[model samples]
Target: GLLGRYTPLDNGTDTVDEVALLELMKKTGYSMMQENGQRKYGPPPGWDGPPPPRGSEVFVGKIPRDMYEDELVPVFEKAGYIYTFRLMMEFSGENRGYAFVMYTKREMAQKAIHMLDNYEIRPGKYIGVCVSLDNCRLFVGSLPKDKNKEEIMEEMKKVTEGVVDVIVYPSATDKNRNRGFAFVEYESHKAAAMARRKLIPGNTLLWGLNIQVDWAEPEKDVDEETMQRVRVLYVRNLMLSTSEETLQEAFSCVRPGSVERVKKLTDYAFVHYRSRQDALDALRLMNGTLIDGALVTVSLAKPAAGRDGGGATWRHGGGGGGDGLFLFQRENGGVEGRRCTTPGPPGLLPAYGAQRVFPLPPGTPLSPSSLQALKPYQMSSYVSLLEHFCYQHSWSPPDYYLFSTPGPKILLIFKVVLVSTQNSYLPDKLCALVEDARELAAQHALWSLGTHTHTHTLGPRYAHTPTLTLWGQGTHTPAPTLELKFVQELSIILFD
Candidate 1:
């Protein structure tokens, strides 16, 4: 419902509750999962070789909020030529204050840590250098509020001794409080598992409230085996502009319902399928495909260690980070291997909350990554999109105004007072204006930005028709305008 409010507020223009939405999911006999950690999933039995050598992947934290891959490369290039580096992204496609850089050599990574550690990348934002670990931390949910880190640490002492520290993310809404969850770090991945393992026997309480705990690494990706207890295809190198809905639509074309869910991150995402065969099919078809002109690398994801549900330790996107629901197929009144019912609608990810939408059937869980094709339009993303279009086309600010009509779905309306100006509306010029406007709109996600709705939906390849005829018909009649579609996190919509 807050998708409307999430609309961006421009110099003129247009962005939902996360808490209220989470409560709704909880009422549905389920809770959202945790952040999906990053990984290069290997084969079914898993990669036989040792993980990347330490210092091969350097963890750089506390990065400047606006720093992107281009800017990040030079900082680490001081160490050596980098193979690639991925900034930990928020669901909104913004940087999440950290990054992982893969160097051509491990020693170069160590050199980066030494040269950049504690270096102030931005005022108040310094580079926190470390090696990417296996995320030896647990996200404790349904936690009681008002307790400081010390008290939370005290609670962890009861569960295990290998405790390192407890960190509760400050509330996005309130500064004086936390968001009711905390990360319990351990000395080792084994100790972290020991603590989370105890919680699996049943629910555990941190402060009189039943709290669910899972591996709480927000900046990493979990293997596919960690996913459905199943098979999946991992997609990476996505343009920050790509929307989850568009990703789903592209993969769904691989085969109907062949793609189940997408776990979208800052720059990459995961596509889960129903079966191993389906996963392989998706990988084979979509490993290197173009979506909105961006090339994405899709490949079979590796499976995680553990049984499904109670024994499964790995998870990704929704409910919370790094956690997904347990799937069990009952075979002749007895449960067999990990399997969920055919997916219903897409569901929302608890971690990302309102930024990305995932609609699903009753009692089913959802996560980010892909949007269901053809998402409804809102004033939020359009606010920025509209501004961008106006800026690009040089629309007369006073003569052109954009607003939204609110109903079951938000209807975005763009109105321009088109006077008979042959100077601005020459044959070739008008064609360019219309084409450029359409191109801007086309850049929108099929899930976010919409296709033509008034006429027969005009896709990119559709033949040209008069997009604006009001000026030719009569200048005094209703102004001629067009509607564009876009799906993106509201944060990206903000003009301020």
Candidate 2:
């Protein structure tokens, strides 16, 4: 009577009788209604073969409500031999608008996704298709808090196949008890799927309680490409007053000089390392660790913007001088400036030198207006201002000036030794700024700026003294004007 009342092709007009439905399923090769109310048709009416291998299943969604297996199975058959077709159904005898189709081969399932995804099942009605994830873990909730891992594993083995391990978390409130849920890892997706089918609501109970069972969600937030074997760590959430030297000392605990450089920002920093393993170890050990009473987060540094191949090009807007901005290309450890329309101070011209240059740190503000704020005729005031600017930005004062050939246009060469409080390296930002201007000079034959390690027996010398030398061409204006232009160019390099 149920077979007569409800047929496989029947479209949701009548409810099928359970007795006749079972007889109909027997004849049509469909399994009995599952605990979740889904009807599974494996080896669909033809061959008695084992289930398809993994990776052969595709999740199909967006089925019309009235659609049934008679309509869905044929469309999927166009892909390949059907190994299993599971259509989830409601109690009202309607399909649940989504299904899983397993092909005899993985290639066929992939083909089904390409050909039938968005395939029209009805007018203006299409289905979405994709490969189903083969999850090997099942989440079992509402477990007895008294049950330990070993006891749960023992009980689970009595009801399911392939029970590899049971992971239970301890309760935060009470350490003596579990959190009432545990993840059961299975040997394969098939084992977990079968276990889930058996453990659905009203089918089986654990410890006389109906527990929730579902596939454990897989992790998707690992940024593999950006973090692949990176040696630089980007750290954030630092204390505002944290210094680069402090960061270097903290990060170099792995080994002496393990940390190559530490670029400290307001409340963040980038730590560079020579070895990838050292960076990984540091990230694992130092992330969320307290520094200056604040916990810092450390992760692999992503490649910054404007990086092309192995070089970087930084373009800035017109600086405070109203002079057009300069373009600096960083390649081969030198920053070469180009298209700088800012002319040298009045009566100063180009006498190029082919030397490499470096840029100052990003976001370092070197004010051109500071030099302009002073009167060129006031030598004492201008020199004091220069020393003050360097001191304010934690730089050593400019003390060494090598004057060459007294004339109306004197070649004034001055060197400022970059003072490192504790280490042999110069600040990378300063290196970039000086090198950029040096290369710009080389391009136009205007002036020269270069870095060198030198010792002065007559004065205090650093262990590794890297000096910024500006070789000025003959300028009619007082040397202060030329000095102002040098500072302005450096400002442009460090401004943006």
Candidate 3:
């Protein structure tokens, strides 16, 4: 059998102490027998070596969570002459309770094992050792809430073989809930190798949960600024033949300049631009555009920084403040201009009787029934109803209304009428209208149900009213109220 030996100090004193060495061998699990004139001892034929180097390579059994290098080093040194020792610490300065110890000499290491193996450093705790390699495994985290053990196992199965075991950590307080982490073990090294090859970070599911894999070591907390500068772009729907160069060519036309580098990933390509602005421009212009007959989507190149200040500001449609205005000649022979503004009436309206009259229609006119119904309300009620109606439809009322008030009291009377009609039928009519609109939206799979209130009012009075009283007559029912609330709640479930 080959003797597994390690040299501690190259120039250290070497003298034979056969008797003590032989005795140590037997205690440490090595076999020994006297032959002719010399005594020879070797590891048992089937012994792998020190039961696989416990704390050094594989950490098993409970150890103090607060164990540290300074504390652990002395204990291991006393057990065996330590050559190298390290206790892994997290970036936040927390001890990982793991330490690696190397004996000054393999013989000394073996000697220490005889004296210390199965001997508790602390009561009831024994240490083990094994040969360690540099390769380390990491656990991926932040899985979706709805993801199950079976689904995760299926994903891992694609990369490895020999299903050994997979343990999903659950919330300590909630057994049925995941703590967003899991560990997988394989029967063979090859299986672990396969898993490492297949499971990568940023693998997304329909619910927007990302799958991440890492070595089973504590990670350094990255600086916020450092994270901001890095960006990841996940391009999808890419042409199969598209290479890094092809993607570079497609994004090369971005106005703010081209990508700094492009790389082809598993099924897509990652593009890094000189600046975030360049990346944003590329996303806006290149996304959904045909690239070799395939529609490619462009997104941020890396995980976005959690801090609000770092991301690139994306401007689309046009450049500069005045770019969006459209200038056209109107039928009245005057030049007219239009631009997107707050949903209300146009801010810079032409005079009521100007030559152009702006040509743009005023915000939707109140129906005759709506005006008549509001006849009994006070001016405050009218204002409240108008505000509610505007908000419910996501509309903004005109800045100025062309009202012909006969007197202050008459004006008040007219305002009251407007409020009554609006309050009575507006919510029911709006709900019906929204339902119709929602139906249309559903046809294209574009609608997500949302809710306002039964009567779209700003103050507390509106909140406490019977659902029926707000909508008036046939429209009054608890169904729409419950339906709206349910829709709001269901939206969370649907998206999640």
**Of the candidates shown, which would achieve the greatest lDDT relative to the real structure?**
2
lDDT of 1 by residue, 249-348 (tens): 8877656887666656544566666666777667777777776666567765543334542222222222232112222224442222211111112231
Residue-wise lDDT of candidate 3 within 393-427, one digit each (tens)? Answer: 56533111111111111110000111222221112
- Top candidate on TM-score is 2
How many residue pairs clash in model 2?
A: 19
Instruction: Please estimate how well model 2 matches the true structure, expressed as its whole-model Cα lDDT.
Output: 0.55
lDDT tens digits by residue: candidate 2, 376-463: 3432332344445455557543322111122224232222222222111112111123223322222221111124334332111111
TM-score to native of every candidate shown: 0.24, 0.32, 0.22
Q: What's the CA RMSD for each of the models?
A: 28.9, 26.5, 28.9
Give the alpha-carbon lDDT of every model: 0.46, 0.55, 0.39
Regions more than 4 Å wrong, model 3: 1-53, 56-137, 171-177, 187-194, 202-210, 218-496
Model 1 alpha-carbon drift over 4 Å, by segment? 1-105, 108-133, 201-203, 218-496
Error of 3 at 343 (Å): 39
